[model samples]
Target: MSSSRGGVQPLMRAAELEKMSLEQLKAVKEQADIEVNLLQDSLNNIRTATGRLEVASTALHDLSLRPQGKKMLVPLTASLYVPGTLDDADNVLVDIGTGYFVEKTMAEGKDYCDRKINLLKSNFDQLIEVASKKKTVADEAGAILQAKLKQLSPSS
Candidate 1:
């Protein structure tokens, strides 16, 4: 009987669902559907972030192995790259967030990426659990609604 995100009411028992009017059941189903969709979007974003962090971590490791002044192609945009040389492989710029970048040593940069990846993974797991519960609620509501409609049909 625990509360769900966005102040959604707890999942009701089948008896309670059976007592509700069609409109009320529909409202419950719609709300649960919306919440589940939102959670799914969040989960996707977290997954993308984790993937980017993993890439960053791998790049950092690769860079650490290269000597200073190594030739490289710096990406200016998705389709554009500029030739450049690694001036200081030991120090790299890390984008913390919100247009803020910080200079960190290679080890620190790798650590930061690992930490962010772990954090995003943790959030992803928790959100998955919530999304599953919300989906169950929506499915149950839809099932009950269908049953009610069937009972009221002329063929019944």
Candidate 2:
């Protein structure tokens, strides 16, 4: 039995070896808990980053593929105007591709895509940072447990 700090008997086997093994196990368990917490935080960060990327991707697609009303020109038919309509003939308009408005709209879309890409990259960076730290902590904790278990083994 272990020496009691008070007058009461310690709630453990009195053997020294058993006490040492119990202490080591307790330490290992604490380390395991810490490692688990770190890993969970890392996973949360990665999930957040993935969600942000998906949202950005969806927004980009929506903006780029948005339908601009019907582009077809109205059919040219004599019924569209009076048979002797000389004023309509003088006021007809033709389609000229690639105007200033189209260029401005395309430029806006490009800017939006670039911004979303940068945001996604930032989120991924944060995820990597957390994951790397978590991996390092988990590796160290695992090594400590392995070493402790080896020491406790009878064949060691």
Candidate 3:
């Protein structure tokens, strides 16, 4: 919500809300819609991250059971696969982010994958929590819009 003087306020008391014009009410509704959309986007991102983490965890488990120097078709993309053979089975490349890589033992790589999964799960949970709160705010804004519209209705 914004005050008459143009500064934005996060929440408006009931009395302050009484001062809002129809245009301001509409603007508030718009802002709430925007917030909901942004939250939805964040939720989608969390879903994607969670899915990738699940796949990583599974891949790590499968790798731990494979024989050393096992031949496998490595995925380059959704449709592309390249013939590849594992090296030591004891040594693996771990990505630390930003295209950087580090060498680690297989056990260490698996542990790293587990830690990454846990961190992503924690983050995903937080996003869901925040999205739930924003949903409540969006619902309230919708109710406010409805009330304001009723007050301005011809039957009012």
Candidate 4:
């Protein structure tokens, strides 16, 4: 659950929505749209994190296969790579987030990536459920608003 949505009120029921003024319905619809967008953004971020973790896991597997003193191009930046030789294939530095890195054995690094990927996947599944509910609420509110508008126009 996202802390950002802690202050948001629950969506009104369909029966209650019918009794709201035009302006009130519009407000509810807008709020629902905003909430849905936020949840979608959260889902996207989780997916990206999962992808990065999977890549790291693959890299760890590849590194474990290489012999010591193997020559390689170590990336200093996206486009900048410097020639280097493998120092310790058994041990690698793992980024634990918040600008921190911890040295761990290759097996341990792979395990960390797997754990993080699983955690992110679980969170993504939960967020998808929440986002689906929010979409339903938004759709219902929009339908009600359109009906109200049609009632006012009468010529359609």
Best by TM-score: 1
lDDT of 2 by residue, 1-156 (tens): 212322112122224223345455455345544645765676576566556546644644544454444232333452463323122211223222254222234345445546655765676676566545544544544455566678879992
Tens digits of lDDT, candidate 4, 1-156: 123555234445788778888888787778778988998999999998999899889989988999999999987776899999999999999999998999999989999999999999999999888778777777887899999999899593
Candidate rank order under TM-score = 1, 4, 3, 2
RMSD of each: 1.9, 17.7, 3.8, 2.8
lDDT of 1 at 56: 86
TM-score of each: 0.92, 0.38, 0.78, 0.90
lDDT of 3 by residue, 11-95 (tens): 5554554566767766765765676677678778767866776786687678778897799988877799999987666777777
Candidate 4 ranges with C-alpha deviation above 4 Å? 1-12
Candidate number that wins on lDDT, 1 or 4: 1
Give the clash total for candidate 4.
0
lDDT of each: 0.87, 0.46, 0.70, 0.84
lDDT of 3: 0.70
Ranking 3 against 4 by TM-score, winner: 4
Candidate 2: list runs displaced more than 4 Å. Answer: 1-104
- For candidate 1, lDDT tens digit of each residue in 1-156? 226335445456777777889998898889889889999999999998898899889989999999988999987766899999999998999989998999999999999999999999999999999888888888888999999999989992
